[model samples]
Structure formats: C-alpha cells, structure tokens
Target: MITRVRSELTRYLRTETVGGALLLIAAAVALIWVNSPWGASYQTMVDTSLAIPALHLDLTLADWTKDGLLAIFFFVAGLELKREFVVGELADPRRAALPIIAAVGGVVVPAAIALAVGHGAPGMDNGWAIPVATDIAFALAVLAMTGSRIPVSARVFLLSLAVVDDLLAIILIAVLFTASLSLLWLGAAVACCVAWGLAQKYRLHTPLFYIPVALICWYALHEAGIHPTLAGVALGLLTRVRKDPGERTAPATHLEHVVQPISAGFCVPLFALFASGVPLNTAVLGSLFTDRLALAIVLGLLLGKTIGIFGVSWLAIRLGVAKRPVGLEYRDMFALSVLGAIGFTVSLLVAELALADVGAETIELAKAAVLVTSMAASVLGSALLLRRGRVHQARRDADQLPQGEGSTK
Candidate 1:
C-alpha cells in the first residue's frame, strides 16, 4: 500500500513537472502575442464576453479562466490535501509540523513585508496577499529540472507546504477579497454542497450525478460574489478519503486522479496564457521604477518567502516540534523555500482582485511584477538547487553502493 501510494505520488509529480514546462511555454506565447502587432487582438480575445444571463453567468474569457477553469486546479489540490490529512504524512504529527509551520511563515511574513513596503501607497496594501502564494507547478518544475537526485522526502515537503499555502490563499480570497455576500445564492451553494456530500456518502459515484451538483455549487458561489473555485475545494474535502480493504480506491483519491490531468494540462496553462499578457508600453516601464507596488511585491516574493519559510522551519526543528527529513540538509531547506517563493497562479488572481479599484495601468503593472518576480525566484532557486543537487547525488551514489564499497577506497 505504501509503495503504491509512493508510485502514485511520483506519477503525479511527473505530470506536474511537464505541466510546468507547458505553463512556461503558454506564458511565453501570451507575452509574444501581447507585444506583437496584433496586440489589440490579444486584448480582444481575453475581454471577449461569454454570458448566460439565465444562469447568472456573465463573464469574459479571462473571468472563466480564473473563476471557472482554475477550479479544477483547486479541486485536485483539495483532494491531495484531504488525502494527506486522512491517510498520508500529515496524519503523522511529527511529519506534519515543519511544513505547516513553514507554510504559515511563508504566508504571514511575505504579507507583512508587502504591507510594510507598500505602506500608504494606493493598492499596495490591498495587494499584500499577492506575495503570499506559491505556484506549486512552477516550483516543482524547477525542482525537477534542477535536481534529478533530490530526495523524495524533499518533494513531499514541497507538496505539503504548498497545500497549506494554497489553503491560506483560499481563505484570503474568501474573506479579504469578497465585496458583498448574496445570502440566497450563498445558501443555494451550501445546499448544493450538502447534496453533493450526501451523494458521495451514498456511493453515488457516477459523474452524471455529481457533475451537475458541482456546477450548481460553482454557479451559486459565483453569484454570491465569492470565488467560485471554493466549490471545488468544498466538494473535494467532502469526498471520502479512506477505502474499504475490498475497495480499489476511495472516492476522493479516484476523483483526484481523474481531474488532476485536466487541471495540470488544460486549466492552469489556459489561465496563465490569459492572465500573463502584460503590455510593455514605455509608460508602464517608466512607472515600474517609480511605483512602490512592484518593488514591494518583488521583494516580498523573492526575499520574504525565503526568510519566512526557512526561518520558521529551522525554528520548528530547534524547538523539537519537528525533525528534518532524512537526506535533506540546511541548504536544501533554504533552496526549497526559495523555490516556494515563485508565486504566479494565485498571485496573479490576487493581483487582479487587489487592484480592481485601481486603474487598468496599475493592474497591468502589478501583473508584470508577478511575472518578473516569479522568473527571478525560479532562476535563484535553480542556482541554489544546482549546487545542492550535486551534494545529494553524491550521497545517493554512496548509499546505493554495496557494503563498504566506497569507504576509504
């Protein structure tokens, strides 16, 4: 059972690794398209409207990417998180402590730095959450690319920390960003969630039965002005994580396996393509140096995330609340935390929400900052990992040898 779970996780990480590369390609395409002579066409494409007023669904393509497609990504995340809590590492208090602490530090410290740096600056304070997120796909991609010999334990830590960080981001989106609440729609969404849970409880595993309920939940949440992605998280959390010995897989695990590909391959890249096309006008470039928003965001992501996650994790270890995983070292933790600083997917969404009241130019500037900062983090993390990777590879080689094979030889 343990081997099977490990194999499944390895498969999932490989999928995400490939997806990260695709995400980069998609972002590059968007950049080129936006800067190309047909830049107007690129703008038109995202702004294009798709509305079903009868269903209270009136949204641009960009809106659908953020609120609709991104839900799949969150759903997979929710499933992974549920599995960890139910039957995975997080169920072990010792294993769970460090990542949980690191995740909290990663969120709070970056937010503090962002708030402090952007103090009294319009829209800067509001966008504090922008630096609080970690792009799991991109971070894992860099890890995969940079360190073939990296320990499985390190990967586990990354996923765990990311899961907690994502949960925090979800809470922020729900609480801090929500403008108004529609009680009727909110109640409807809750009812749909309850019905979905009951269906799962009764062994109604048919996609036909669950899909409609899920969509209704998503629609209701959207109408309530809450981020519709929460529907995925709610449904995912409701799904059963444990299976009978006679059963092949739990509903939650099965659902995650089915949807993860869709999330990694389709939803995320689509969102990146739409969300990452910031214009490079001279005015924006000139404003970048003058604005506090970009600097605060960049520093928060690049510096604050590393300090927060690594520092808190070290503290946890020192306090005996947690122990370092086998085969990982101090530098490895620092490098991993640096990789965690690459915030893009949720960060971009937050950027949009944060600057809603600001001008279009301000919003664009913020998005540009996210793109720049994510790249910088990626490069810095890869550099750190490149050195760390050699150390780990040598350790692995020594471990793989026969007894006394390489000792003093």
Candidate 2:
C-alpha cells in the first residue's frame, strides 16, 4: 500500500498540468486567505522566524520558502538546462540559435520598456528585472492543455526558449541583487561545488554523500551574501549528464527525476502560498494602474514580452539568421510569444528582492502586477492557442476525408 501510494504521488507530480494547477490553486488560496477576516494569522505564520545558530541562519517562514525552497526549483531547472545543452534541442548550434536569440530579445526588450515607463520611480532600477522571466511550468502547462493540435516542434521551441530565458534571469539575480560579497565564504562555496563535481566524476551516487555537500554549499553562499539559490544552479550544472556504457540513465537525468516531483509538488507551491498573499483592497487595486512601477511591470509583461519574442523571431527568420521550427507558422509563433508573458514564479521573487529596501507596500503592488499580468497573459495566450488548434484540426480533418467526397458538393 505504501509503494502504491508513492507511485501515485509521483505520477501526479510528474504531470505538467497537475503542477501548474497546484501552483495556481496555492496562489488563489493565499489571496483569499490573506484578504479574509483571519488575514492576520496568515501574515503571522509567514512572519514567524526560525533561527539556526549553528548555521548562522535566521529567517522567517517566507524567507525560508523564497531563499531555501526556491533553490530546489532552480536546481531542477539547472538539470534540465544541462541536459538540453548536452543532448536535447539546444545540443546543436544551428538548432539552438533561434531560441537563444529569442530569449535574449525577450529579456532585453521588456527591460527597456520597464525602464522607459518607470523611470525615476522608486526601485525602478532593480524592479525593471521583474518581467524578464518565463515560468517554464506555467507556460508548458498551458501549452499542454490548449495546443493539443499544434505541432510537437512548437513545444520544443517553447521549452528551449524558456530554458534560456530562465538562465538569463538567474544570472541577473546573482549579479544585480548581491549587496556585499565575502571572498572567504565565496571560496568555500566554490570548493563545495568542486567537491560535488568530483563526486559525480568518481561515480558516487548516494544521496547521503550529496545532501550534506549541497547544504554546505547553500550555507556558504548564504554567508557569502550571494543569493543561495545560485548554489543549486551550480550544483545542477555540475551533475554529470553523459551516460556511461550500459548505464540506464545519466546522473543528471536521475537527479532531475527524483527532484522534480519535490520541486513542483512542494517547494514551488509552498513558495506561492507565502509569496502571493498580497492585499487587494480598493486602494491597492487602484494603485496597480496609478503606480508607475506597477504599471511598468504589467505593460512590460503584456506588451513587451509579446513584441520582444515575436518581433525578434520574425526578424531572425526574415534575415535568414535563424530557422523557424518545423510546422510552426508565424501565427503559431505569435501565440507562443504571447504565452511567454506568463512570468509568475521568478517575477515574484524578483519583485520581492528588488523592492526589499523600497517598502512593503511597493512590494505588494509589484506582486499584484505580476499576478494580474500573468493571468491576462494566460487567458490571451490560451485563446490564441485554441483558435490555432481549431484551424489545425480542421486542416487535419479535411486531409483525412475521403478523396472527392465533398468536392463540388
């Protein structure tokens, strides 16, 4: 019975739709709970602090979710990214260029728009980074549900684009958010990463060997004043992706399979629960439009992402710089570009980090913008995808019809 239950849980967590649904549900519950009469309890729980003197860690429940749990998500992302570069869609330079360029364009244009709109606004310097990421799980979930009739290559293109998009966002987080750096702790973190790589090379496959090293690396980074999440990415990239003869799977692949369920099922949803509890009173709602920073985030996501992704992709194909995915027309690409605007997960993190010094009210408004913009992007993207699906379905049905059956009728 225990084995069966474990099997069932793994299966559910592995489903893309289930993970996305759970994330949304968690965010919704947070919104409702925080706005209800018992809202104070929600804040109290999130604010409850736990200290680890041995590790020199003191963080609230919310900080733990953001700084600690989210690292697991990034680790999984790192594994997928390494696999893609080694063997997946991004393995070949020719096949990789389109998504890479599109990802860059997606990042740059939204940032430019944000800067243009929110110039001189408080926290605009860092807050402009908020809309540059595409949430892989959320975007893939929407695609899986609505793009059933779309060609398989479209999904591949989306996946590749998102992976590169996330890499850029992680780099930005590491570079832009570090307030101070301690070389001693940074050296310790680097040594731990090297140790992890050595373990992989030596074929040490036990979790007992890795969990402690990973924790130490995370703590080292935390003490170094770097975002500890970078430790997860480093460890992930260090994991071996190549399989030896007679091996069933590469170490990276195995780790991803083991860790993905935990990241999706628990870590991300729990983060959403704590991070998404923004107050939505009349003033806050009004402020979403009136506040320049909030307005910039919303516009950057809704307009900037679409224009950046689709516009660059179109130009790249026209100039013969990159090839479009097979079976994907410009219309389908536009839909995918719209889907790219769903920047929920990383955007929320950036909103918090960028505005940590700005004030709680500004942070709340920024998060509200992210949530609203993501919802709008999802609806718009889904509508476009469903329409495209219907068109493709009609074409497929017509092609399958008996020859001359309806001709001249």
On lDDT, the candidate that comes out on top is 2
RMSD of 1: 4.1
Give the poorly placed runs of model 2, Cα more than 4 Å off: 403-409
**Runs off by more than 4 Å, candidate 1:** 1-14, 281-286, 398-409
* Positional deviation of residue 38's Cα in model 1 after best superposition, in angstroms: 1.3
- CA lDDT, every prediction? 0.88, 0.94
Q: What is the C-alpha RMSD of each candidate to the true structure, in Å?
A: 4.1, 1.8
Model 2: weakest 10-residue lDDT segment is 400-409
Per-residue CA lDDT of candidate 1, range 109-201, in tens? 999998988888889757888899999888888888886677778889998999989999999999988789999999999999889889877
Model 1 pairs in collision: none
